[model samples]
Target: MVKELDPSLNESEFLLEALRKGHRVDGRAVYDMRLIELTFGSDYGHVEIQLGRTRVAARVTAEVVRPRPDKPTEGMLLFNTEISPMASALFDAGSRSEEEVLISRIIEKAMRRSRAIDTEGLCIVAGEKVWSIRVDLHFMDHDGNLIDCACIAAITALLHFRRPDVTVVGEEVTIHPVDQRNPVPLSVHHIPICVTFGFYANGELMVVDPTYLEEQVQEGSMTITMNIHKEICTLSKAGGIPLEMDQVLRCSQVALVKVTDVTEQIQKALADDKVAR
Candidate 1:
């Protein structure tokens, strides 16, 4: 398996030096994140998010399927993430890379395991049929922080998604078209946003929303998933440099602030879209 070439020694040194001096090449403060922009498609449940140069698109779709044998009362929420070579040369066309696997797992834990969606609300008939919601995420651009960008896209799309209304009469189930009946939105419990921090200089210098170059040269990183309600969904750090207790707490504080801002933006965008429609 081939890998993308690493940054030159001189380039890494220059970046590290700038970071140590509390200066970011992108002109952002040490703990500042890049600007986030959300764009919705004409069709419901389709959203595109741009975090600086990183771009991700998410689409939500639902289907009627038999309920699981073990949990007949609950529906399903599935996620599929695709990273093509077009997003970055490091990723291949067909196979899954290590980073891809990590991103998928973290997202699953953050969204599904965290119970952000009320799966039981999707049931059309207990033990008979249920709505299976699937979220498809595509990485259009990969500057850095694909995980955070993908999370934003996923939640926004899910909130924007509307499923066809279903009516169950005795043993028969009837699905209504959107034109004939107003579609029903999913029961989203809370939005879990991901805040990723890049560590440098052996964890002394840290920055939020690291760029592609910064990622390649960073010593380690951590991603904290939080909601606007002050709840933590997940905290992921895959072995690069161990962090102190104080560092973890500080990172969590930063994550909360970022999540609050992002949530407000999402709400405002949704309201604006509703008005437009």
Candidate 2:
């Protein structure tokens, strides 16, 4: 849905003012993200995230299922979405559309590119049975830059999630809950975070973590997901306008700076959880 904008401010005028101030409409530098908060759960695989005004909750649940016909030895990662009507009038609880498809793809891309979750470790009894982990993301709020927030939430949740231990004896596997034993964490290679940048009209402005209003009026938008090693995991472009190669490169550089802060925050959150426990 097209977010409503302030009646008094026109897109051109807003861009001009921001350009003069060396800042964006939201009072953020071109590479700054709004405040971020993350919470980790001790119970295997629960995470809560807050990015500015947007919030997302994720839970990781596992079940033993027959492995895919071709890949009998590896487990699978399934991503699902639930956009309640309460979250936005634009989305209906029962409806599925292109928006949902794109959201799923963005999350999947980040997961696949970052290798955030280790699927091979999930196998038990090989061809006979394997654990399938399902990640469910609930978009509680969508203030702006859902992709970045969602990616962060997904990765954090995966890192925090733990699964019951499985013991195999004579081809028989038994599962033990977290309470019975220390749960096994999903193997993660690296943590990656996403940052979004918006390019507006007049070659006059760029903004990071655009609010819904800014996103609605921007000429073009791009998201860059980067790992701690400074490798680009995913680069996505949305909106109707075209972007130059130089512009894209500039955005990537800015994204790297922004993602560094994001990654630190996530790591801090994880560390804080350990201290609390």
Candidate 3:
């Protein structure tokens, strides 16, 4: 389904003029990202991210269950998304929008398909019982760049989350509480971050971290998910204007640099949280 953004003649003209003059309403360069802030909740595996005006929260939880027969050695990793009406007037609580669907797909590709979390490491009893990790992302505000912010929130929450330690004695499973034993962190292979680029004027002009109004006026958008190692997890384009091959390569290169910076930020936040804890 087509997710339609409101069109405004006045806003379009204003943004176009600003871009033509090599300017942005928020005074950021074309490639400059808006300020990003991440806050961890008191509980384990809860994180809130603020990217410019967009806000997203992620909560991570785990449950023990029998592993799938086909993949008994591996645990489970699931991602779920929710968009609140307060996030945007265009959002319907009961229905999933194209943007929401797009976000979920991109995140799943980046996290699950990329194997960011070590599922095999999550196994305690192999085929008998294993931990199933679930990450839930909630859109608190939609100022644009929801995908990038959501990815950051989800991954950070996963990093911050700790699962209960389990001990199996003669097929009996015992889950230890935080007070009884120190919670263990998930074994993460690597982090994959999503960076988006918005195009305008037949792809002549582009910007990073577009505002909501800027998104409405953009001609096309592409999201690239990559890790600090410069490995491309996935590149997603959802019916936007066609981009040149060279343009795609250049954007991927830019995404590599951007993801590296984001990875550092996330690591620093985690380090601080550890000290606080």
Descending-lDDT candidate ranking: 1, 3, 2
Which candidate should be chosen as best, given TM-score against the real structure?
1
Off-target runs (Cα >4 Å) in candidate 3 are 1-7
Model 1 lDDT vs. the true structure?
A: 0.95
Stronger candidate by lDDT (1 vs 3)? 1
Per-residue C-alpha lDDT of model 1 across residues 191-233, encoded as one tens digit per residue: 9999999999889999999999999999999999999898999
- lDDT by residue (tens digit), candidate 2, 124-151: 9778898898989888887877778888
**Each prediction's whole-model lDDT (CA):** 0.95, 0.79, 0.91
Residue-level lDDT for 249 in candidate 1: 97
lDDT of 2: 0.79
- State each candidate's clash count: 0, 2, 0
- 79, model 1: CA deviation in Å? 0.2
| Between candidates 1 and 2, the lDDT winner | 1
For model 3 the TM-score comes to 0.96
Q: How far is candidate 1 from the true structure (C-alpha RMSD, Å)?
A: 1.1
